[model samples]
Target: MAEKEPPGTTVVIHGGNYGPSSQQVVCPNCHNRVYTVVKAEVSRRTHIIVILLCVFLCWPCALIPYCIDSCKNKNHYCPSCGSYLGTYYN
Candidate 1:
């Protein structure tokens, strides 16, 4: 069993650093009603590799990755706290 914290204790909890994007979401970190800091749908690891393929293999081949699903993901985060809420696949 752990000891209880004193009455006047200040605990600072912080979140992670997600990409730059403005979105509205409830911040679990600060417990704010809602935070607007949605990030843009960023590319995935596979997408980068495929993009390289487009450059190396063929320039036009780059479009191939865009046409396919799972090539990118939409990341949602809290604007106020920057906590990762979830990811939406497009």
Candidate 2:
């Protein structure tokens, strides 16, 4: 069963699997239909991978994780109101 949120609390529930791309969604803040704008950010996991690659493998290859979208987190925002919606973790 799916989890539920507490009463009087606002939550941004995603319809499907979100990715590093723009998608159509209903803005909870603005109460309007709009497309989401995605921004890629380096996460802790990416930092760990970079460190491991540099220590175990090579320093040059350590940058690979930073260049890959799957190694980062995608932050979703409502274009209409610019409210933070959610984050897509890889």
Candidate 1 global lDDT: 0.58
Give the per-residue lDDT of model 1 (tens digit) for 1-90: 988889975443234333344434446767875544554454776578677987797776767666654466656666667767766554
Which pairs of residues have clashing backbones in candidate 2?
A: none
Tens-place lDDT digits, model 2, residues 1-90: 998878965444565466678777778789887778999999999999999988896897889988998899999989878889888888
Q: Residue 68 in model 1: shift from native, Å?
A: 12
Give the TM-scores of the predictions, in the order they appear. Answer: 0.44, 0.75
Off by over 4 Å in 2: 1-17
The TM-score that candidate 2 achieves is 0.75
What's the residue-level lDDT of 35 in candidate 1? Answer: 43
Model 1 bad stretches (over 4 Å): 1-24, 45-58, 61-71
